[model samples]
Target: MRHTDVVIIGGGPAGLAAAVKLWEQGIRDILILEREHHLGGILRQCIHDGFGLTRFGETLSGPEYAQRFIDQVEKYKIPYITDVTVIGLDKEKKVTAAHKEGILEIQAKAVVLAMGCRERTRGAISIPGERPAGVYTAGVAQAYMNLQNIMVGKEVIILGSGDIGMIMARRMTLEGAHVKGVFEVQPYASGLPRNVEQCLNDYGIPLKLSHTVTDIKGRDRLESVVISQVDEKMQPVPGTEKEYPCDTLILSVGLIPENELSLMAGVKLDERTKGPEVNEKHETTVPGIFAAGNVLQVHDLVDFVSMEAEELADSVAEYIKKDEKAEAEHTQGEEAEEYMADVVTDGNVSHTVPQKISGKKDIRLCMRVRRPMKNCAIQLIQGGKVIQEKKMKKAIPAEMIQIPVKAGILKEKENLEVKVIW
Candidate 1:
């Protein structure tokens, strides 16, 4: 088996950033494996601007943002292989992948899972309709337009107010295609505030909140989609059905973290994030295995993904140094599984990542609310007592709440709860 100091799966923003950070930490012998022929991941398909606003302070396109790190990866001469599909990962940190050269197995001291996320397709959402060619995921249409130079269709009816859908509504309008309207089951826009304002409002694309595409009347290609208003239960109001004629129906329902490899490697998963359960260091329950980026939790922006990778790189360094010290001492035996207290949530809180708190260190809880709340307060409670409380102007499920709690605070009590005071 070929060996490496660290093996990073999926050479996207997460992998690239981690490699760069790890190299900066004086750690080399890193290998990044990517399934695609090129790096950059989904960023290559996103041609529109508005990226890098957080990190670079300059509004950049997705490709431009990704190139910033890709250039760094090349400048540092970090080794990475394209068109290599990682098939399996063992608990022992053995990675099995298939390449043109043949099956390759890598024994790694540390493995960073950066496979990112996948767009939820028609089947996943269970849209009632005939399987039609004109139907496409927002990401697919994005790729078709930006990378392949192909226009998907003339008229589009997008389902779901996901950021991609909102962006595509404006993108299609710019490309001379008519975006009839964007339908969302939720009352509020699911994407960012800026995306809703710029991509939809500015383009005069109608955002039909509290509405959904109940039925699609397409056979060979898309003919029309039946739209209807939904009640409080998010169920379609029967008599409110109206047909919108369109050749293309774009689905941008949601994103699911690509965590099969993590599960295969025996990493415990957070049900809410649908990703790996990580510690503050971003290390998983499996000692040498770590996760970052959308694979760990679906991040709203690429900048956050990069930040996670930077921190994760440091954690990997810490793991390596500790492992080396243990080996030298001949005390490198397997570590007994330690108890990790659950970070429970109540009220409008949907879920919290790094669900299990282990060791004593300052922790950042990345959480998402179940719904939007105005003039809300967040509380960190320990054993029915409020340890910390902070007020917020607003909190939305679409945005991740980065709550920092000081170290040694978790060990102070038996149960930790995050309650949203609305």
Candidate 2:
């Protein structure tokens, strides 16, 4: 078995950033394993502009944004093998990967999980449709069109208003296809505001919220879709069904984090986030195993993914630097009577990350609301008392919410819950 200082799974933005940071931290024995032949991950298929505004201060396509990090790996001469799929991870931080070279076992001091996420396809979301040729997820269509230079269909009907669906609507429109409209089961648009405005509104594409496609017509190729409006319970309202003709149906329903390896490593997962539960340092329950980026939780922007990687790099470095101290803390963490402030959600709040927290350093808890609200305050409660609150002009589920708190305040409470109060 070969040994490395670190083994970062998945060579996407998160893994790339982690390698760069680890290199800067003087940790040279790092290896990144990517399943794909290329290292850019999903960014390579996304050819749209408007990325990197928050990070690079410039509008760039997905490939251009990823190229920046790829260039860094090449510049630093970091070691990474492509077309290597990591099969398993153990609690001891051992990694099993399979590549052209054959299966190999590597013992790593630390393992960073950046396997990213997978799209929810038609089967996962229960999209009732015939097995048709023109059906595709937004990402698959993107790869086919942008990467393979192929046309999916002449007419398209997009389901779900997520960023990808909206973007595909604009993309298909630009490619000389007629886009019928975008349908959403929820009352509010699931995509970002800018995406809705730029992709759909600017393109004169209709966005049908509180509506869902019930029946997908056609057997060989998509011919039409039966859509209907929904009530408060999200059930299709009777007699509200209407048929729309389309040659293609693209689904952008949702995404689930890739966690098979994490499960094998015996890492604890947060049910709400559908990802691994990480602490302030982004370390998972299993020591020396940390997760970041979309693997931990899906971020709305790729810039945040890079930011998460940078943060994870620092955490991994800390883990190696204070190896003994970290072990002691881990032991104490098991032996001691830890008073964890459980961040609960209520009112319009849907879910919160880092659900359980021990009063340590400052922590940032990310959350999403159940719906849209105006003039609300995020109330932090402990022992049935309001401890802290932050006001916001508006909060929407489409956008993620970041709440910061100091250890000093959290130490006073045994349990805490966050709620939206208007």
Candidate 3:
């Protein structure tokens, strides 16, 4: 058995970022486990140039962005074990992993789960289709084209207007394939607005909203797919079917966090995000075990993943150095006196983050309205008193709304309430 101060599972952007931060904080006894032969996770196959704008202040391809982090890890001499799969974890931070040589166990003071997410496939969507060779998830198609040097097909119909599907639509077009169109069940496209504009609209790709593939037809490979418009409930509308003859079909419906390890460890999960339920420190229900990146919540950009990882590292450092009993006492005292906040959603409000408030500290409340609104007023109320309010030119569910609370406000309030009106 081996022991480490910090054990980071998964060597993607999140794990690597966490390791780098740990090194900066003078924590040398850290280990990173990667199942793949190399690092970078899904970014290796993401060869597009839209990444790194937020982190590096320049547009870079996925490989380029990954290389930057890989270089940093090497520079810091962060130890990593590749081609090793972590099979089990316990609440005590004991990790059981395996490699070709043999199995190994580690007793870690802190463990960070950054295993990322998996793409939703045809089976997940239950699309009535033949088990044909041409059907592939958008990520699989990307790997084939970008890594294996294999063009998936000459013609394609993409299901799901997510970012991956939109990017692949442009990629297939550039690679001399005719992308028939993209079909999305929801009325609004689920991808980032910039991707929709730059990847699809700039390339003349048609986006079919409130639409889905009802059936697929083919023999050994895909021949065609039958699509139709969907009603408000997403049921297929009769008499609105159309057939598109294509050799390939790519499904990018959604992503599920790879949480088998978390489940095995008895960590609580959030139903809405389908990830672990974490506090402000990114620590799961089990103390000393943390999660970040896509494994916590599927983020739209790599920069966000990096930010989450850095935050987790900071938390881990503090957790390892602080006295457990003292910290628990402090936390209990803080929770006892902390004011609570209720974020009430009105028209077009979906959900809010920082679900609970730790009244001891000033909080930044973030939320999203359900629909787009013009000339909207966002109000922060406390016990029927208008505490803080702001007017905005526009509010959209796609963007996040943030409100900061100062210590002065908490001193005067017992509870926080947020609402939006137009």
Q: What is the TM-score of each candidate against the true structure?
A: 0.96, 0.94, 0.89
> Which numbered prediction scores highest in lDDT against the true structure?
1
lDDT tens per residue, model 3, 145-250: 9999999999899999888999999999999999989999988887778888998899999999999999999999999999999999999999999999999999
The residue-by-residue lDDT of candidate 1 on 97-200, one tens digit each, is 99999999999999999999999988887778677779999999998998999999999999999999999999899999999999898999898988999999
- Kindly provide the TM-score of model 2 when superposed on the true structure, using C-alpha atoms: 0.94
Alpha-carbon runs more than 4 Å astray in model 3 = 323-349, 362-374, 377-418
Per-residue alpha-carbon lDDT of candidate 2 for residues 1-422, written as tens digits (9 for 90 to 100): 99998999999989998999999997889999999999999999888888899889999999999999999999999999999988878999999889887998999989999999999988887878677788899999999999899999988889999999999999999999999999999999998999999999999999999999899989788889999999999999999999998899999998889999999999999987789987777888888899998999888989888887898899898777666465767753224444555667786786777676777767777888888889999998877888789899988888988877887777544767888888
Candidates by lDDT, descending order: 1, 2, 3
Q: Where does candidate 2 stray beyond 4 Å? A: 324-340, 383-385
RMSD (CA, Å), candidate 1 to true, equals 1.5
